[model samples]
Structure formats: structure tokens, C-alpha cells
Target: MINTRKKLITYLRKRDGIKPSLQATLVNIRCKLPDVVIFGGMVRDFGLGVRHFSSDIDMVTTASAEQIRHALAGLNPVMNKFGGFRFRENGRLFDIWSLQDTWAIREGHAQAKYLSDLCRTTFFNLDAVIFDVHALKVRARHGYDEDLQRRVLDINLEANPNPRQMAIRAVRMAIQKDLQLAPALVEYVLEQLYGTSLNLTYQSYVRQLHDHTGRTPESAFRFEPQLKIW
Candidate 1:
């Protein structure tokens, strides 16, 4: 695990990779106050050895939201509805928040009381990985490593903000990443496809897919039938 973490940090610290000031700012705040950890897409994508990962970074800490706001006051941080302080520095978006305010854990949609627990609550297995920017360590859920190895698109948690919307995301991920949809994920997508798909209009579904993934409806639909892996 340490070796994998080192690889991840090495990539992030590379000359053309993650901006040095971005990491330095987050780590410095974490050092002065309570521990701050980096997780979500940034860790997930780069941990898989993706060099052109997205620019958004997500972080959580034991510090209070107010303290975090003060720590990042220089960036002109704005608190979002999710109780996270949002700032843009070096042309990258950073979301830093108190762990107590994580929407899933706070709303009972998922459970995690510590830094390690944070990775287990994500909607997708591929995203359920974390790096403690301060501790210089990494942690992942049970199937996390294998999912990355195999490039399989699947769910880690069923109850999320929008399961129907995620069905589209699963298809987009499978197509975009060239991943196979796991049986359980196929099962969930099928249930949502035939079951609650009526909850959303066909145009809305197509629009959402395009907006969320930048893939046209034709691209998503062409890959839709592949979900029938049985």
C-alpha cells in the first residue's frame, strides 16, 4: 500500500502534474490544524496512472468548517451548500470541508466516522480511494484495487443522491474507460433502466448524460445494450 501511495504522490508531484502550490496549501493547512486528506476523482484517476486527470480536488478534515474557511480565506473561499469551502487557485477547483458535514454521512445515506471510512462511501468503486496528504498514506475499499486493475465500472454504494442519473454515469464510465460492467452493476443499471427510468423523461435522460459525461445520446445508447452482460 505504501508503494502504491508513493507512486501516486510521485505522479502528483511531477513537474507537469498537480500544481505544487495547490498541494502545499492544503498540506500546510492540515499541518497547522487537524489532519486534512485528499480523495475523490483526483486520487482515483491518478492512482490508476492517468496523467490527464480532471482538475477538481476534494478534501476532508477533522477541523471545523469555520476554521477551514479562515485557513483558506486568502483564496476568497466560498462555502457551498454541502458545507464545503470552495476555492480556485492555480486554475484548479479545490473543495475543503469538515468531515462531520459530508453529505452522505451527515444525511445517513452512508456511514464513515474517520478518515479511513471516507473512501467507502463513494457511489463507484473506482472513486473509493483516498490519500492522506499529511500522513503520506493511502487507503481503499475492499474491491478498489481490483476495480482499478480490471478497469471495471461498478457501484460501491446503491443509495446515492441520484441512482437513475448514476445509471447513465455507469454506462459513460464503462465506455469512456473501456471498462466492463460488473454483474451487480449491470443488475442495478437494469433495475434503474426498466424500473425508474420512467421517473425521468427521455430527453431529460439524454441531456443529463451529455451534460454529465460530455457524451452524446447516440454514444451512450450505442453502449447501453452492452449492459446486458447476462
Candidate 2:
């Protein structure tokens, strides 16, 4: 497991060939938002030893949306409702979101009195890791490395989870990483599939898969049987 921040950074640099432009952007964003961290898929893939040819990076900062926009003035950022700004650099899309903003938008989260509180709520799986840009460190909450190593999909029950989103993600991760959902998580997913209106429709799930991978839904679903989502 990648235990240190320095090792994680070096691994990413070597594995992703993180371009100079991307590094400069990270440095620039950090100048304005001192607490900015990179999170989500890029970090997960890195931990799992999976390499992507074109990865979309996700970042979160303690800075407000306006502050982030001012920090990234020349990037032509498109503001998103979720306290995020999206922009393209060297043909890759990068999303930067505000920590407080994301916390506010979600329901049932404890008041985020500290950054650590927000970080805990932001992640789903153990692989939902973060990279501290300023400190040059890779950090994961408890259970992160263990879950990654076990290839288990253990959902964060404390966090407000979207059932449909989780179901879709479970399938994608199962296919991409050959992971198995923990039995409890499997029950939760099935409950969400039948018991909740928040479950993602077949069409919506397919669309999401297409948007991320450009693969047809049929191809994506081919892995569903292997996932044993029954």
C-alpha cells in the first residue's frame, strides 16, 4: 500500500505523466486555496494500480466558489451548481469544488466544524483518497488502504449516499477493477434497487457509463453478471 504522501506523488507523476501544465495549475490553485486537495477517481485508480489514458481530475478546496474563480481567472471555468468549476487543459477536464459548498448541498451530514469532518463525508469507498497539494502528501481516511488491498466495495454508511449513483459506481468498479461488493453492501444495493425511488434508471445508468467511458451500456452491463448484483 502507498503509505506516504511523497511516494503517492511520485507514483502519480510516473504513472500518469502529469503534465507541466497540470502541475502548474495545481500550484496556482494552491496559492489561492491553501487547503486544496485532489480526490476521487484519479486517486482511486492510482491506489489500485490502474492507469488511465485520459483521466479527469477532481479537486476540492476550502475556498469559496468566487475565490476559486478569481484564483483560476484565465482558465475560462464554467461554474457548476454544486459549488464547482469545470475547465479544460491540454484536452483534459478538471473539476474544482468548494468543500463547504459540497457539504451544504448534501443532506444529513453533521455540521462540518472542521476540514476533517468534511473529508470524511466526501468519500464513499476506502479508495476515495485525497492528495494534499500544498504538503505534497497522499492521505486516506481509516480503512482506505485495507479496502483497496482487499478489492472490497465497502460503502460509507455514515455519509449521505445516492443509491442509484452507488449502484452505478459499484458496477463500474466491479468491471474496471474486478472487485466484489461486500455482502452487506450488496444487500444495501439490492434494497436501494427495489426500495428507493432514488435508484438510477437503466437509461440514466447507461448514459453515465457512456459519458465516462464512451462505451455502450450493453458492454458495461456485460460485467453485471460477474458482479452478481442479484
Per-model clash counts, in order, read: 0, 1
Q: Quantify all predictions' global Cα lDDT against the true fold.
A: 0.69, 0.62
Give the CA lDDT, 0 to 100, for residue 132 in model 2: 80
lDDT tens digits, residues 76-160, model 2?
9998755589998766788988776664344546455444454466535754577888877677767777777777776664355
- Over 49-123, each residue of candidate 1 has an lDDT whose tens digit, in order, gives 665655678888888888887877778989886778888877778888788788778788766678788876788
RMSD of each: 7.1, 8.0
Task: Give the range of the ten consecutive residues with the poorest summed lDDT in model 2.
Answer: 217-226
Residue 230 CA displacement from its true place in model 2, Å: 14
Best by lDDT: 1
**Model 1 weakest 10-residue run by lDDT:** 214-223
Clash pairs for candidate 1: none
Candidate that would win on TM-score: 1
